[model samples]
Target chain A: MAEEVENFEPKIVAFLCNWCSYAGADLAGIGRYQYPPNVRVIRVPCSGRVDPLYILKALQNGADGVLVSGCHPGDCHYIEGNYYARRKFAVLKNLLEALGLEEGRVQFSWVSAAEGERFSQVIREVTESVKKLGPARRMVKSFEIPKEIEKEIAEA
Target chain B: MDIQSEIQKIAARLLKNKEVAMVIGYGAGSAPNRTAPVFIDKEKDVGKLVFNRFCVNNLSLYLPRLKEKGKIAIVAKPCDVRTIVCLIQEKQIERDKVHIISFACPGLLEKDGKTLFASCAECAVTLPPVYDTLSGEAKEMERNEPFTDRVADFFSKMPAERWEMFKAEMEKCIRCYACRNACPMCYCEECFVERSLPRWIGEGSEVTDTMIFHIVRAIHTAGRCGECGACARACPMDVNLAPLAKQIREDMLNLFHHQAGVDPNAPAALETFKPDDYNDFIK
Candidate 1:
């Protein structure tokens, strides 16, 4: 288990808002910033579009960590989109914590299109925290072959 | 006259005058200690409407579905009326189309008729927040310790242990969705769980699937839950869902300073946000 933990490469899913965090990530790539290659980014039209279900689905589907990034307060291209997202994430975060998800498992951040370096720094912080927590076991779905199927395979 | 007679008289008058097309209220259940919702449309049938401790179901759950039946009257406990106000706020039902007949609730009892339900023990709203015609003067019941205080030890445990505790409770869920059907806030015509296109979670009662269903349901009903304990009562397996409901209620109250179903005009917690809403959790 210790060796497994040592070799663990956490799979993190990052939902980046198209106008801001996605562009910021592009800048990070162009600037060649050195950050962990752990996160798999999915661009969304707005951070407000990140349903709490998406985060839970990702976690249930075996994501070690999830990050949601959007425009800084008062800078959402759609005006108050991020503002609504802030309230939603706040409630969702509290609910997740209440259900025993670690504080760092799901994270929220504001990264304007211009803050490319900050986006890289956020990724590093999220990756480091997730690495310390190891692989998530709770809420991760598992599939087991039916007993009948297993017996058939054995007979075959 | 007792509150029951008063309610019947008012209901009869409403029906006699055609003030409402139907009155949705509780009737005698199959057993002595139970009550089932009954729809009455005739003045003479107003005798079927009864109010007692066993009338625990949140009758407001029928409001959204009953819209096509024309104007309706409902018997509401303080908690039930909150869901009514919530439905009106959500625009699921028109405020004017429904008449609320609320009484000063003598909190509901368990099946044994000895103990109060946990929700009534912590009875927060003694009076209906919005009522068209109230029947009796609501009496304040002695407050039990807050639900949060009851779960403080669970919260103090490590995250993994807490998850185990919550998962144990969720494992009892058979995915019958009795709780969902009992909830007035869950008015989505096609719930996300039923959507095959995205297939949000597995269909059967896998532990993870059960956990996610309860988790997402709690999240979906976050700001809107009335803490009415309807869902808990509806669970045939007797899974204790009070903790998740209470936690979300506490967060909604503490974080947003909002209590749902109280003021119909107040902006919904998730739908509207102040420019300076709490976001310290964000980095």
Candidate 2:
């Protein structure tokens, strides 16, 4: 809510679905893959399990970039869940780009349980993208709204 | 091609399922000209099922409140389908807990013979393309106005007039939270307006309070509203609030490339922040 101090480490929230992306991340860890340490993962059952509101809430609550990874097509633990995510992300990607948000802020990719290396590569890429864009506090336009409403919004 | 018979048939089958506690879909109202969301739990109620343009409510919004033990099957239009997808994505409801019956959805009928909503008319695609059951004529996608063009035309009006329009529309609000309660996305255990700790909104509500409620509600809806018209339909006062909600939904699409209820994997605009997110309006 104030001036950007030096040495600020951007906090990225990565929502990884348990069936695929989570296992992929664990694979990255087990293999000792090196990537930026910014992302904090919230694991769910499927990528389709990640709610768009939760992504918005994370951003509003001061997260910088959110990466959602799920099983590749046809591999979802729940059949066709990722397909629904694909349709949703297509629109979401368009909306994010239109808002003038940096293209890399909300990244989506298919990472199966075995794609450990691909998961690491994605995290590295997302980190690089977020790094070039810099700190994202300006992403929200709600600063000037009244205090009462601000309190309510913060509560939201 | 009459969908009423099909709906009744589905309702009958749903009621017969011991696991299905209810089947929430459109039903004929007391009047010929109106349609409403009907929760059918008993076999006798299957006769109430109806399908018509006046059946504009997105019955899926009633999903989150239902007890999880019983399966609930819902009839969804393409637009309503997105809401169902969004709900499942958010973990507000489990995907396996409910069933979906859908239509390729020729879009909403205005009860005046119109085939689509103003937003639906401009929409570029049909989604969640698969369904548990299908109904109506499978409509082919067609080109129409762009969402932004309609928005620009709407906003080109005088500012004071626009404010007057909003104020007039909002004056009809009754603090029923019918709109909130009718929304599938508004599944918070304790909604912000209901909290007293910081008292987000004073409970001794009035026109001003009501206005604040709607305005903030619209803002909160920013990218998440699906334009189901559930708010206006549920409103006892008929505030005709869909226009405002639709605007933000379009803006979210036009500006942020985000559509509420469409995708499970994609992050919402404010949810997953980018370091360089557009904040031109922030002071």
lDDT of each: 0.88, 0.67
Q: Which ten residues in a row have the lowest lDDT in candidate 1 chain A?
A: A136-145
Quick one: best DockQ, which candidate? 1
Which candidate wins on TM-score?
A: 1
Cα miss at B97, model 2 (Å)?
1.4
lDDT of 2 at B67: 51
Q: Which pairs of residues collide in candidate 1?
A: B104-B138
| Model 2 C-alpha lDDT per residue in residues B84-171, reported as the tens digit of each score | 8777776777777787877655545544554355556655455444467776556664634222233445456554455455556656
Candidate 2 residue B67 C-alpha distance from true site, Å: 3.2
Per-candidate TM-score against the hidden true structure: 0.94, 0.57
Error in Å for residue B24 of model 2:
1.8
lDDT of 1 by residue, A1-156 (tens): 878878888999999999999999999988888799999999999999999899989999999999999999999999999999998898888888887888899999999888889999999999988988889888689877899998998984
Lowest summed-lDDT stretch of 10 residues in model 2 chain B? B274-283
Q: What is the lDDT of residue B135 in candidate 1?
A: 86
